[model samples]
Target: MKVSEALSSRRSVRGFLDKPVDLDTLRRVLAFAARAPSGGNVQPWNIVVITGEPKQVLVNAVALKIATGEREFPEYTVYPEALPDPYRTRRFGVGELLYANLGIPRADKAGRLAWFTANFRFFNAPVGLFVHTPTYMGLPQWADLGIYLQSVMLMLREEGLDSCPQECWVTWPETVRRFVPIPDGHLLYTGMSIGYADPDEAANRTNAERAPVDETTTFLGF
Candidate 1:
């Protein structure tokens, strides 16, 4: 697919088909995705991709915690305590749009919470990729990680697959550590669900909005 097509096709897909993602396709995506630029060639991203039994085991561990009405204090703040104007509004808008598509009313708190459990379930995706980095990696290295993951998503799009980059996994560090093998120095940064999208799922029909370039960009020398 052309780069423009890949960028346009990519979205945070909330539901996936049971069909297996071809392993060779995933490998090709990753090989090119790793070419994402890193400062001074210090590529800090570490990835652990799981499917089948291993992915199910990890999902079960996280779901078990939620089933018991438990919450794990996330190692990092997923969002600000009080997000600033435009961003806060954008976040709220997307949630409203998604729930609306799911036929969930604003009053359906229980329904909404139940639906959230699907994050750990990988939205029924067959493949789960956990991204990590060494504990000592600074903010710039973390930025590099984001670039790399976006490349992964675009490549998946190119491969006629979809993905959702989930920071929700950050809340289940212990559960992930127990089930996913990681070297001593690494810390779980995020998780990604990758697979064929279920076209019939209403939750996947999100009308997520983005700011216009004029509103978001500050042209200094254009």
Candidate 2:
């Protein structure tokens, strides 16, 4: 697929089919994703891919913890507590849009929590991936991780697969470390779901809007 097509079609798919992705296809996608640039060529990322029993083990464990009201301490803040202005507005808007698409009313706390719980299950995607980086790395390395993941997502689109980059998984560090072989100094940065999207799912159709260039960016010396 063309790059433009991949960018346009790639969305954070929330539900997926039971069909398994081909191992070789996944390998190829990662190999292609590695071509994504890194500052000073540090690369700065590692991943543990899980399928079958291991994936289910994580899903079950996290679901149990969440259901039992177990608290989790994430390694770092996922979002600022006091978000400012347009950024906060955009976040709230997309969340409302997502729930609206799911037919979840504003007052349906249980309904929303039920959907949020699905993050651990990879939205039913057959493959799960854990991304890692050494704790010593700074913000630049974290940014590099985002670029690498974007490449992976686009590559998945090219391979006729779908993905969701999930920062929420970082909240359950212990559950993830038990399943994935994370190195001692490395921290779990994020996770992803990879598989065929369930075409009929309404959540998959929830397209979050983006701000126009004039609003979000400033052109200089153009």
Candidate 3:
């Protein structure tokens, strides 16, 4: 698929079919994604791809913790404690639209919790990718990591795979680190669920709206 097509087609897929993604296909996508540029060529990203029993084990552990109310270290806040202006309003609007489609009213905290819990299950996808990096890395390196991840998602889309980039995995970072046996000194950056899209699921249709380019960008040249 063309780059433009991939960019437009890629979405944060919440539901996936039960099909397994082959290792070779994943490898090829990752190889292409790794070409994303980084400052001073310091490509500081590590990915742990899990499938089959290993993936199940990680999910089960997190679900058990959630059931028992045993919280691990908290992940970074997704938004500011007190968000300001148009960005905050935009965030609220998308969230409202998504929950509305799911038949969850603003007052239904339990329903929202249930939906959030599904992130631990990978939304039934067969493959989970945990991305990590050194804990001490600066913001620029983290920015680079984000670019690399976007490349991965776009390439996966081009290859006919759907994906969800999940920060929810960070809530169970220790569980993941233990199951994956990742060494110390690296933080779990995020997780991704990848597989074929489940066309029948309503959750899969939740597309967060984006602001128009004119609202977000400032042109300097005539």
Candidate 4:
């Protein structure tokens, strides 16, 4: 697919069909994604692709934690405790939009929790990818990792596959580390769900709105 086409079509797909993604297809996507630029050629991102029994193991562990009332502190704060201005308003709007699409009213706390829990299940996708970076890395390296991840997501779009880049994995980092055997020096950054999107799912119909270019970017040179 053309880069523009891929960029325009790509969305964070929440619900996926049960179809499995072949390994060869996944490898090709990752190989292309690895070409993404990084600071000083330091390719700091490490990806663990989980499928089959191993993926189920991690999923079960997370469910167990939730059942046992065990909560993990996020490795990093995704958003500030107190967000200000347009960002805060934007976040609230997205939440409201998503819930509205699912017929989940703002006052239905239980319904919201149930939908949030779906993240741990890979949104019913067949493949799960966990991204990691060394704990010693700084902000620049983290930014580079994000670039690599975006490359992966876009590549998947080119392959007729869909994905959701989830920060929700941070809540079960230790369980993931143990199951995936991620080394001690590395920190689990995020998880991604990859597969064919369930076209019929109501949540899949909800797309987050983006701010206009004038609001987020400035063009200096004419």
Candidate 5:
């Protein structure tokens, strides 16, 4: 597929079919995605892919913790405690759109929380990936990781697969470490769910709106 087509087709797929993502396909995608730029070619991303019984074990453990009111402080803050305007509003607006499409009303707090638990389950996607980097990696390295993630997502689209880059996994770092052998002193940056999109699922209907180019860009010379 063309690069433009991949960019346009890629989405944060929330639900996936009961189909398995081929390991060979995933390897090829990652191989190309690694070419994503990094400062001085210092690619500071490490990934651990999980599926089948291993993935299910991690899901069940997190589920039990959630059921018992257990919580762990995230290694890094996913968002600002008090987000500023426009960014905060945009984030909330997307959530509203998703819930609305799922037929969930604003008043349905319990339902929303329950639905959110699906994040631990990879939204039923057959493949899961944990992304990490050394704790000492600074902001620039983190930014590079983000770029790498975007590369992976777009390539997945090219291969007729879908994915969700979930930061939610960072909330259960200890639980994730118990199952995935991420090396000591490495921070789990995020997790991802990969597989074919479930066309029948209502959650997949959320096509989030993007701000216009003029709203987020500046062109001094042009």
Candidate 6:
């Protein structure tokens, strides 16, 4: 698929079909996605891919923790303490759109929380990837990881697969560490679910809007 097509089609798919992804295809996608640029050639992204029994085990463990009201201190904050202006509103808007599609009203806090637990199960996707980085890496390295992740997502689209790049997984750093063999000195940065999207699911039908280029960009030299 063309780059433009991939970018246009790629969305944070929340529902996945039961079919498994081909391991060979996944490896090739990851290998090619590593070509994504990093500052000073420091390719800082590390990924632990899991599926089948291991993935289910991790999901069960996190479910137990959630049941017992256990919590882990996150390795890093996913968002600022107090987000400002358009950024904050944009975040809220997407979430509202998602829950609305799921038939969840703003008043249904419990329903929303229950739906959120699906992130641990990778939204029933067959493949799960946990991204990590050395704890010492700063903002620039983190940004590189985002670029690498975008490349992976786009390539998944090229292969007729879908994915959800989940920052929510960072909330269970300790639980994930117990299940995945993340290298020493590295922190779990995020997770992703990759598989065929469930076209019939309402959550999969939600498409969040984006700000126009004129609103988000500036043409200084043009």
Alpha-carbon runs more than 4 Å astray in model 2: none
Pick by lDDT: 1 or 3, better one: 1
Instruction: Mark the regions of model 6 whose C-alpha exceeds 4 Å error after superposition.
Output: none
Cα lDDT tens digits, model 1, 21-116, are: 888999999999999999999999998999999999898988888889887766688899999998899989998999999998999999998898
What's each prediction's clash count? 0, 0, 0, 0, 0, 0
Question: Residue 148: error of model 1 in Å?
Answer: 0.2
Model 5 Cα lDDT, one tens digit per residue, 107-201: 99999999999999999999999999999999999999999999999999989999999999999999999999999999999999999999999
Score every model by TM-score.
0.97, 0.98, 0.96, 0.97, 0.99, 0.98
Best candidate, TM-score-wise?
A: 5
For model 4, the stretches where C-alpha displacement exceeds 4 angstroms are none
Task: Tally clashes: model 5.
Answer: 0
* TM-score-superior candidate, 5 or 6: 5
Model 1, position 71: C-alpha lDDT score: 75
TM-score of 1: 0.97
Candidate 1 deviant stretches above 4 angstroms: none
Model 6, 1-222: lDDT tens digits are: 899999999999999999999999999999999999999999999989999999999999999999999998988888998999899999999999999899999999999999999998999999999999999999999899999999999999999999999999999988898999998899889999999999998999888899999999989877
Summing lDDT over every window of 10 consecutive residues in candidate 4, give the lowest-scoring window.
173-182
In model 5, which regions exceed 4 Å deviation? none
Q: Write the per-residue lDDT of candidate 3 for residues 5-78, one digit (tens) a residue.
A: 99888888888898989999999999999999999999999989999999998889888989999988854665
